[model samples]
Target: MAGVISGHPLDTLRIRLQQPSSSSSFSALKVLRSMASSEGPLALYKGMSAPLASVAFQNAVVFQVYAVLSRAFDSRNGRDPPSYKSVVLGGVGTGALQSLILCPVELIKIQLQLQKQASRGLGPMGLIRRIMEREGVKGMYRGLAVTALRDAPAHGVYFWTYEYTREHLHPGCRQCEENTTTTLTLGKMLVAGGVAGVASWVCCYPLDVLKSRLQGEPAAYTGILHCFRKSVREEGPAVLWRGLGTAVARAFVVNGAIFSAYEVALRCLSSYQGGQSPSPAAE
Candidate 1:
């Protein structure tokens, strides 16, 4: 949710920048300033509510699925608890599967944000209804391929790095050796998640750029291959990395906060459900 809210404005600016006319007419900074001036700063947040709701629902579902799948595997393997690799794999699988739910919300949000400067009369609901009316349900999923392509790896890396750090960095964390009452620490997860976020962003940024362009600038691309070729040819290779800094910054801040909060939430919930008092880790 933090990621969705904090990043929307920048996301808007990014879409505008990809428009061919926007490239020659305005720099990214100018576009941001222009939007603020013309539409008010809140205009940059046009579709924020959907993304916030999406994030909350998606995270809840994905994490629950991951935990359940991991536990099932652990029981089947008789390993007492799963390995970090199993956890990471579970997370990857969850992320990929969740793309089905995620894509539509993302599509709606992107369309809404970009609609601020729309060359058409259709606003958010109108555009969505039109897509449903014209292209049926599938239109909402127009760029699912690239979304899955980018997110599977990005989310895989995120979970992989987080689990890997927890496995290796703190001796016996996997065994809960500090104490049964002691859950994973927020500070620790924040540090780990921050690192993981940076790694994920770097590894998957180009794909993200591709995904964004594919969704926000359909005329600019025919498919993923064509998107890459055209982005390079028209915007120069570097433009493919246009909002990388903002993305990385967003990942560092948002993921760090979310992962930390999640760990704390999970610990608290576990404590409450177990009929045990909250531990220091829940602090």
Candidate 2:
């Protein structure tokens, strides 16, 4: 939730920057200042509720699916470090499965974020009600294919990179998994997480651009392919890469905090199992 809150404003900016109306001259600072002047600072957090609600479920879905898939190969036990191939496969599966849930959540968020009038502060429930009344059920999952395309390979690369980077940072993590006294190197873990986050976004940002366009302006194009062709023809290939810098930057910060929090929670729970109760509330 903290990660979502902290990164959502930048996310809103990135989405706007990806829109067809934006261009090389549509600077992040300029857009931000425009939003602030037009809609107040809170406009930056316009679509937060849907994604905020999704954080726990999304992470749980990702990690849970990863755990199951990781354990599926070789003679590996629960404590063994998964092979990189297994990591990628697990992440891909996780991403595909999670997209079914995430698609609707993001559809609502995108609509809320792009709304011209933020003065009234439309809530998620209200926005959801409106979409249902007007566009029906299919509207909520408008960009599922594009979402899957963005997430599947991105998540695969993400899990692999995090595992690879963490192993490089602390080669002993695999050996120490079962040790109750073993402590993760906080600095190394955070670095690995940040790098992993950046890797995921860098690998699949163009698909994300399409997903945003498809959802935000569903009537503008037939589908992802149409959206892609139209975006490139009109804006050039470079348009797909727009807002990438903001995305990678946001990914690094938000995912660094998320992974660190996960590790802390895992440690706290492990300690509790050994008859110690440490508060994980700080996380």
Name the top lDDT candidate: 2
Once fitted onto the true fold, the runs of candidate 1 whose alpha carbons sit more than 4 angstroms away are 17-28, 71-81, 117-123, 167-169, 177-182, 280-283
- Per-candidate TM vs. native? 0.86, 0.93
* Clashes, model 1: 0
Clashes of 2: 0
For model 2, the run of ten residues with the poorest summed lDDT:
274-283
lDDT of each: 0.73, 0.85
Which prediction has the highest TM-score against the true structure?
2
lDDT of 2 by residue, 143-235 (tens): 999899888999899888988888787777756764545455677668888999999999999999999999888889998889999999998
Taking the candidates one at a time, how many backbone clashes does each contain?
Answer: 0, 0
Model 1: clashing residue pairs? Answer: none
